[model samples]
Target: MRRYGQAVLMLLVGAAVLRISLFSALYLRYVQSGLRPYLIASGALLVLLGVAAGVRAAREVPDEDETQDPHEHGHTHTTGPRLAWLLALPAAALLLFPPPALGSYSADREDAQRAAQGIGTFPPLPSGDPVDLSVAAFTSRAVYDSDRSLKGRTVRLTGFVTHGDDGTWYITRLLVSCCAADATTSKVEVRGADAPATDTWVTATGIWHPKGRLGSSAAWPPLLDAKAVRRVEEPSNPYEQR
Candidate 1:
């Protein structure tokens, strides 16, 4: 039972790694920004514990007089062989078929929200080169005012789709603090084009135009000129890439 437990735990760890690697949003929140260092530290601790458990299990052996049947004792007392095979379950899952990215399923999940205090006002760009702004920035500004400063500026954002209302499509980028357990959602309402498939990664280059009012929430009223739009693979570290 101990061996089985260890095996199951190891498999869970492997699945987590697979999910984080393949899914960009998960990678950004949990592995990139805030919780990255802690995850590394925790990973090291887990490795040490696994090693200690393995060593102790290895040293444990049944006495000759303890069992009447040699075969039963042989199978029950040996730990390495039993636990070693369990690793293959995760390995096979990874190799044979990996999970897909977080898709439109989480569109309505309201994990994305901006910080009220720390997120300062959007600064004016030099207006020389194309300005780079995150979806978080746009969402923050939309809460306070619905101005056109963000209009006609080239903006870059990556996230999954949340929903579409009227002619606008709502997209979201998830910010994870630790594991998927503590993920927050930041959203952008895109206009001037038909909504892309929900939960797919996209780079939208457009001019920001303030449109209608959101709910009792802040006013985000911004539209993308949508000069260009294309789908891309989710990056290894999918958050702001900061």
Candidate 2:
């Protein structure tokens, strides 16, 4: 049972990995697209192993009844490891119910305590009304740019809302390198009106207030004086790629 089950579990795992990697959006929630090739390769290998195991099981002769007849013309068949079936749980879960990406809850937990990097000059912005910017990019400009680069522009930032104990609301977005495990969040204080429910996806159009102390790695983030807040559905890809 154990050995045969191992092969079957491997096959299922491989198929699930390939299915999510190739045909579904599930993998995008956990890791970047760069992992697709590796996932496909792993799935193929597992399937091959399972096929080999099945072939071996089929070719074996039947076992004799030990108690009834030792001299009887019969053979014994080997069963795979009995406990190897446990390995199927993860694969089954992933196949049936792939989880969503980290969101407001995850963002709320990760403080901006990451070691500072690339904290120098920022380039001028191209002309536009309500200039579009990612949450992370806006945070970087607000915190590190000494020139107040976001002074006049009405920037549009989209993220889920997170409520702070101090009665403030934040436009929060998680930045992930390759997966959620290493994700960090960039948050901006939302001012000008009452904040919506926590974890609500919103597009906050606002002007930068320069409220937080800038040019230093202070825990406080820059504030956005929100002129308009529109509730929106969560985006297909939740994490901001860093």
Candidate 3:
């Protein structure tokens, strides 16, 4: 088994990647959806490499009558470090019990790093009473849009619930530029509606409650006067693509 450690490690890693990107949508929790094809290809390559390595190792066996060490003939045999097999533990975990997507804990770790986009006029929204918008879009318009496109219009936003230290609760979603490692938080302060459990997915319909000057600190985390809140299943792709 030790002789085939490298092959086993490769197979474990390949299977883990395939389990998330090819067999399920779990890859969305870590990477952008558009990268799925690359992941699948890489996984397939790894599996093939593992199989090839196993075959080569099997064929390198010495004859029973030839007990000379290969090193005595100016040849040194090399294999992966024994400790390297520990790396397979994480791969096995990923294959068996993929972790959930980033939620409130990840959201809380981010502050107002996204406020640098100065205030500007945004395009008019489509004609409708209640417009469905992504959490990132709503946050952008509410915080920086000079036109106040969301004012007086009932808008719907979906995200998990996150609580502030001061009893404030927000409907929050993470925005990823490439993958979860670069994820940023977007949220709206919910008013007039009780906050559900933390990490609970919900769709909230409300009117924009302008708090302060556009692009100011006070305008951050723009408030929404929610009229209705409904529990919903978590989305397959939890992070919003920026």
Q: Write the per-residue lDDT of candidate 2 for residues 53-147, one digit (tens) a residue.
A: 87786676644342445445465433334345667888888888877778777877776663365456689877887998999889888877777
Candidate 3 error regions (>4 Å)? 62-80
Alpha-carbon TM-score of each model against the true structure: 0.62, 0.84, 0.91
- Give lDDT tens digits, candidate 1, residues 35-141: 55555455456556656666665677744544356476555455666666676677456534555534455445553333344333456655653566677666665
- Clash statistics: count for each candidate: 7, 11, 0
Model 3 lDDT per residue over 93-117, tens place: 9999999999999998877765578
Candidate 1, clashing residue pairs?
Answer: 111-184, 111-185, 112-184, 112-185, 112-186, 113-185, 207-225
In Å, residue 155's CA in model 2 sits off its true spot by 0.6
Q: Order of all candidates by lDDT, from best down to worst?
A: 3, 2, 1
Q: After superposition, how far is residue 66 of candidate 1 from its true place, in Å?
A: 7.2
Best by lDDT: 3
How does model 1 fare in lDDT? 0.56
Query: Weakest 10 consecutive residues, lDDT, candidate 2?
Result: 62-71
Question: When superposed on Cα atoms, how far off is each prediction in RMSD?
Answer: 6.2, 4.2, 3.7
Candidate 1 TM-score, C-alpha based: 0.62
